[model samples]
Target chain A: MRNKFAEALYRLSRSDPRIHIVVADISPAGPMNEFRKEFPERFINVGVAEQSMIGICAGLALKGMLPFAYTIATFALYRPFEMVRDDLCYQNLPVTVVGIGGGVIYSTLGGTHYAQEDITIAGAIPNMSILAPCDPAEATAATEYLVGADRKGPCYLRFGKAGEPDITKDAIEPFRFGKLRYLRRGRDVAILSYGVTMGLAVKAAAALADKGKSVSVIGCPTVKPLDREGVIEVLRSHPRVVVAEENAPRGGLASEVKSVAWDIQARCALQTITLKDEFVHCYGSHEDLLAAHGLSVPAIVAAAGG
Target chain B: MSAAPRRLANDFDTTAARERCYRLRRRILDVSQHVSALHVAPAFSCMEIVDCIYHGLMRKDESGAYLDTFLMSKGHGCMTQYAILESHGTLPRSALDEYCTKDGLLGAHPDYGTPGIAASTGSLGHGLGMAVGMAVAERNAAKAKGRPVPTIYTVLSDGEVQEGSTWEAVMMASTLGVDNLVAVVDNNDFQSLGRTSETHPSFYPLVEKFQAFGWETVEVNGHDAGAVFRAVTARKGAGKPFMTVAKTVKGRGVKYMESVPIWHYRAPNPAEYKQALEILEKVQS
Candidate 1:
């Protein structure tokens, strides 16, 4: 997904002289390397200065220049939160802040590298659009949508580390901001998943099918400006709804669904498969950490009452 | 009364500029009378610096639009900007009269959409980095259009130097060689509650810090509009970024408030207001 974002940006920059790329100390490999090579004048690498990167992007936007500030999720959102609020959100500039390594994608590097609270941080700010793409295809589409002529505001484009599979490939609807996409339809139980966790929901749905029980897999790519009416309708039709995400259980998709269900007083049973509120002190691979924190496929199936 | 908008000329006199500063300070005191919770001392510290920029240093075209941009990173000192903008005719007299009121466009901080405000800044350590970015964009625009680069000036407080983001912008500006960027640090020697020198002893040797970072640095009396004008104009188009350490006094115009920390954000009482006005009236520009 990260590489696809760079490729999409590089392709878009070919004709738009307004597009400028700013990165921190992160090494520019793969498609990003090609972008810097092609547009050396527009590529700016403010070494290890995330706050300055955001401030600089705001200035670029002031001059009618479109700037994309790319860095890791924790560095992009946490260290320079005031900068994001003061420079970007307050002024409501058209700066695309790309935060790679969402959730536990950087699990081996310990808790410091994880980005569990990004959704909460971004959701708290007004006029901030949050997009957590599920795969490379959706990542490209979201990038294009954000950099389009009309999408003029601050936005957070959250992606996983690398090589997230194309879970949204077989979906009936194409990628659109603030829309809930259904990957598979079933009447028994509905599984609502966000970002890279959509694949787990799909696997869990198929596993439930083996027992002659029908299950639906829904992908939630746009976390902010959620499909509230669609979620209420889904709750009305389904007897059970399960939310799967790799973020902290407090303020991600699960919380949004719960809030909507509470407001409508839906009679359906709701459950969430997510990481614990505490930090993950253990070290392992991304899959290992997800399974340990109850965000795996089995956890989603269990949450669905399978 | 509003001053007529004028273009920058080669032989402008400093007496007019100083008198303008005195008038701006008086306007700031007027704002203080209306609003109780604003940084009066902080505003006084940067009055002349901002006045010189808008009235003397920054060039204006025939259309009354500034060719160069100015940002106030030290947000608490926003009354200085509001007063200057109002007097410069960019902002209306009614707006200054209604500051902090329910129907006023002006507030305790500078907002972006307000006329003459480049960026919404009050958060310390934020303006310089954005200034660097504007400088870079101006340079790019100049290179593409074959025109001279426009400058981006920002006023930061002395206490704001403690923020890490300030140095981060400093490093990036020097490395990018943003020659059109100018940062003036209002070194009033006082933070919000205490003296910066007493609290942060290692922060001295400030000019050398910018010089070492590859900037053309200068130190001058911030209250002297002529000195500031000379420092900035002497290095115009000098092929490197510039930093001016303007040594100023908090609550500069009024003797009772000068260098006093308690006067940081206080409106004057009836007796104090009377005394302050009398002192300001008797002063020579």
Candidate 2:
């Protein structure tokens, strides 16, 4: 799925002469091979330096060019948080930050590799718009919006690893940034998920339906702007809301929904199926980690029952 | 009001530039008194480097538009840049007088939207990478127009080199062979708390480190306006980016603050300002 998103980015770069891809040394892997092979002049490899990558992208934006900087989730944003805030966000430069492997996707690499709280840092910054697409199609749509000339400021696009099937259907309005995709409409229970957790949320909704529990799942790709109206509308109608994500609950979608729910005077039970506040010392496959951290489909079903 | 942009002739006016720098220091002192604090020692150390770049190195085209780009990568020393640009008549005097004040267009660091500032800096290690990006952009723009690549100048401080991003930019600049880029290091050897030499003894031999990374390196007396100007100008079309390590004192003109690290941030009071002005006045530029 990430490969499709990267391919879309490469294809977009081909059409727009103003578009450029700058990396902190992720070439010869993923879709970078194609980008570097065809557009060597436009593809810059900064050699594992995330801070320089952001600053360089800012510089390119200042020169009337658009730059997409790519790197792993943890190394990409956390290492250069200050640069992202000061250089890209402060200047409000049109640099698209393509962060791959969000929310424990880097399983088996230990805690250092996990990028759980990327949204928290990115969402907190001023003049920054954030998106975490559920699958490749949504990722491509988000990428197109970011590279578009209409984007007013810096954007962070977080992607879960490849091979997650599309949790969204075509009948839903085509992917638009800052708009939520309503996967199902139901009363009594509203389950909101961002990024890869959408698949689990959908599966959980189906299980709860079999048990005669009415459930609706909403996939929120753009977490920062958050489609405030859409969220408020959902809260107004629903009696129970459960926020699900494969990230820390403190600053992830759960916290954001609660912040919105508190002032709206909505009467709903709030439950979050996310990682605990502590670091995960255990190492395993992606599924094993998710299950151990209580982010599996069963966990979603249980949380939805609330 | 912002001054009208003008393409002043760059014939290497040494005497006039030297005199301007001297007076610029005094002017910075005057402005520093009004503000709660300014980076006086940092500004003093890199005063001539900023002057040399703005006066001797920058190339402005006929339309009074600047063709070249410069970034104060060591942004804490922006007072030096503001002082020099103000002296060159490109910046309004009111901007300098109200610097770092509530209504000042100027602040402790260089901001992009302000008049004549190329990039917002003062965040350590951002300027060099930005300059590299600017150089690459200039190359692409030149290729589009079938013209020469415009030079991009960035002034870095010795302490700023400690940031890993600085070395990352150096690696990329050499790999790309960005000959249009030139970096001037205001090597006064002081960090925020103390001398970099005493705090981190292993960080020396900057010339060799930059050369090892494939930069055309040079060393000079940073205080000498003529020497700083010559070292930068000599690197034109050198087939690689150039770096000048200007060995200097932390406080170049003042009596008590020379080589002192506390003055890196601490501004002079009225009495100290008077004594420093007397010492600065006696220097023969």
Looking at model 1, residue A259 earns an lDDT score of: 93
B15-91 per-residue lDDT for model 1 (tens digits): 88777878888887877778776788899888888888877777767898888899898988888888887777889
lDDT of 2 by residue, A1-306 (tens): 678777888888787766778887775466767888888888888877888898888888888888988888887799998889899998888888888887788888889988877888788899998889888788888888887766778988888777888766542556788888787888978888888878888888889899888887888988878898888888887888888877786776788788888889777787777887778778887778888888888887887773
DockQ of candidate 2, scored on C-alphas against the true complex (2 decimals): 0.70
Residue pairs with backbone overlap in model 2 = none
Model 2, residue B202: C-alpha shift (Å): 2.8
For all the candidates, what are their Cα RMSDs to the real structure? 3.4, 3.7
Name the weakest run of 10 consecutive residues (lDDT summed) in model 1 chain B. B1-10
- The reply for model 2, stretches above 4 Å from the true place, is A27-31, B1-10, B88-90, B236-238, B281-285
Per-residue lDDT value at B192 in model 2:
72
lDDT of 1 at A212: 78
Computed on C-alphas against the true complex, the DockQ of each candidate is 0.78, 0.70
Clashing pairs in 1: B75-B122
DockQ of 1: 0.78
